[model samples]
Target: MKKTLNINIGNSIILIEEDAYEMLTGYLNEIKFHFSKNADHFEIVTDIENRIAEMFREMLLQQQKQVISIDDVQLVIAQMGSVKDFENADEAEGGIYEETISGVKKLYRDTDDAYIAGVCSGLGHYANIEAKWFRLMFLVSFFFAGSGIVVYLIMWILIPRAATRSQRMYMKGEAVNLHGFIRNFEEELAGNQLISRSRGFFVELAEAAGRIVRTLGKTFFKVVAWLIIILGSCFFLAMLVGMAVFLGFSDANPNEYFPLNIVNDAYLSSMVFAFFVALAIPIIALVLFAIRVAFNSRAINRTVSFGLLVVWLGGVMLSIFYITKVASEFKEEAEFSQVRELKKYDAYTLTLDRSRFFSRADSVKYQINSDKYRGKVILNDMDDPYNLPRNVRLNIEKSENGLVTLTQNNSSHGKTFEAALSHAQNIHYDFSQQDSLLNFSPFLQLNRNTKWRDQEVTLTLKVPVGVKLILNEEMDLFSYSFDYWSCEDHGAPKAWVMTEEGLKCTKP
Candidate 1:
């Protein structure tokens, strides 16, 4: 049957029982009477009253109570203390006051003088240190580890704001009782000169500039995080699709031309899986962290973050080890050389046959060596021996014995020289003779069981003096230097004769 009354506390509206209101009003009047003789007595009493109002609002909000009760008023008085307690405290017992702050220190965000969320200020008060030191520590840690931003944001969310003067007093390790409370109220009323002594105009200006920079930095990091999340997600999804289509579902996939095919199928799968794990986990973690920052969500646990880091590190190590294993397969090399005797001939024609070059119906078939040289010839049908080519190059020189000799040199690479030699010997080329005419195969072929190991062939023609050699147009991009000019640059057909000096181009 108790009547309720509406009251304003620290600009907040609150409802309280009539009895509680009377008790609070009498307690505040008593405080005002005690500080009556002081110069700043009015300011001190006003501050204390405001502190009581703020406490009332906090209790109502925290307890979900509809109206403040007498019990609630008495509890707040016990926490803040009565005016008589300050009068009883002695000032001569080797201290400014015999009474000390009895309430335990509490963490609270000091909104009165805060830069961003008052986290450093709250932490400083709780730890009994200067706030600027905490700020400096955060700044240094930001440059070194980037953990400061995360920690600051987390603290901002966790620490409650010091909405009441009593809470603020407790935050600074001051007693919430009347004696210590009066001292703090008077200090605050005294214009806060102690804290503001070092804060000049330049300090305020610098703080303003820092705020602008901090805002810009936040925006920049947001954009960067979004980009990393989106791009990383797209790339990770593409890898998954590729793996599913090529490795997971396909049977007898003929796309053996892939560079990863150098390793065994199982090892390739392991490597790709490791690489995907190495890339995807960090992307996911970073995206999650970005979302937390943008939304101000709960911070990730340290244990979980550390676990993800360890997993990413393991994936990286696995990928590097497997890549090294694959590269080692091409370390050793072997070559094959053979000399074939040619019948008596006054001249010889070095030509690559292109009879069915364009007759293939499948135009989209994976054609090797599809690149052009100086915009002249597209060496599509002729493989480049530098990367497992099926084509061979020809070199001509004068013979010492006045006889014609054709020497073929083939080379290949593998994990061992014996394996390389086996691969090199597997290369097949056809060269047939008809009286004075010698025909050579345009492309070399690898045996069905043989794998590509950068296999290539070179033919050396030992021509006698006065023997003329004609290079056909099909050998345009396939041939290297024969005379002073490059045979690959042949506009039309060219003829060269072996002399005592060297092979000389017959044309101007």
Candidate 2:
């Protein structure tokens, strides 16, 4: 166990063994004495001491040692080179040193030679190309979706600025030895071409624009962050209120609605909560980030942020699981048809029926007594929010057997064929005839508490040739078999005749 001493060098405290401390002191003294005759000796010596301290700290960290050993001091001295090595250089007065070792280059921003952020210059140094070529490439690439601007800003932020002489030397691929250090110091004092270069008109203009943008960009970003904070908080609050309203009003039976009706009632609440968590967490995170930018502080601790992330991921996974589960229900499809014969008539009128048909369960739920409300019909508005999509379609065709008939085709989807058939059978549609008038319902209805499975009804009216028919204007909504609007010029109560080709508009 050799004795250790704490010493202060270049404003940094370091622990070193007795022999290592003596060797480091001697080396520093030798450097100081050699540079004492120079006009800028104090500055050069200070920079060397700071570089030495930085290297020592790096050695301690990389080697995991408590105190600097004699071997560590010798290694540092060899890398920095001895004063005798500098004196023996070929051009010591001109500050031109012999290349003793090939140095590895690092990418660092050369602010002294930069127009904006020195990104191009740093890249040029690393790639051993002229900076003008990189600048021209970036300028040309800016026209392609402004990608060059994004790439340059990213590199500026990611690449460190060379603030020290040693770092600048490393960036320029110069050896970090005594000779290189003195050469760099002399060049800085005498002013190099890189610092004395004149800027072109366009380059000067660009630099001026960059400075203005940077000055205004800080204020613009603050305003944007504030706007995000306000908008995000409002959205987050609205989400909470919406989730509460949906979960609170259980009697409203929201699952009976069109889109929500697709999900199973068993996990409806769980799915809704998961969706809320998944959606709300993002808004919350955005608000927090905005707050950090606007106020320069974190709103939550690292633990809370981590917890929010976990919860958000859980919510996303749960939502995906439920979505897959619901999608599986639509794997199979089934359809069935029914045919009915109508009384013989030379001419008939087809119209949409707005009257709603109520089942016993619906009557009970609305507390309407059948006998008390006899003969009174409840008109269904076509624009009701609770109503499903218009699932009914009508087609008129020439009859093959010269008989008047109507065919109803109903279809639905489910996890299995039998289940799909059951769902299709659960659909209820209304059609009635009074003398020459035929009425068709606008939408199909499902049995009570039944989930939606893409149920649909298609009606086909087959009439004998030469038979004439008058159709209501609203009937066009259910007919896709022909260009109904084209028949509008025939006059109100559009008339059609069954021809060999099919139904044709009759003359006004």
- Top lDDT hit: 2
Q: Residue pairs in steric clash, candidate 1?
A: none
lDDT of 2 at 251: 87
Say what the RMSD of model 2 is.
Answer: 13.6
lDDT of 1 by residue, 11-47 (tens): 6778989999999889878887888978899888778
- Cα lDDT of model 1 overall? 0.72
lDDT of 2 by residue, 1-508 (tens): 8999999888999999999999999999999899887889999889988988888999999999889999989998999889998677625453333443656688997776887878899889889999999999999999999999999876765677765776788789987666566656767865754544465665556556556666577678789999999999999889898889889998887888878889999999899999999999999999899899889999999999999999999999999999999999999999999999999899999988878655664666678886676656668645332657768888899999988999999999999999999999998988999888998877787776889898899999999999999998778778478878778654488899999999899863
* Deviation (Å) of 444 in candidate 1: 3.4
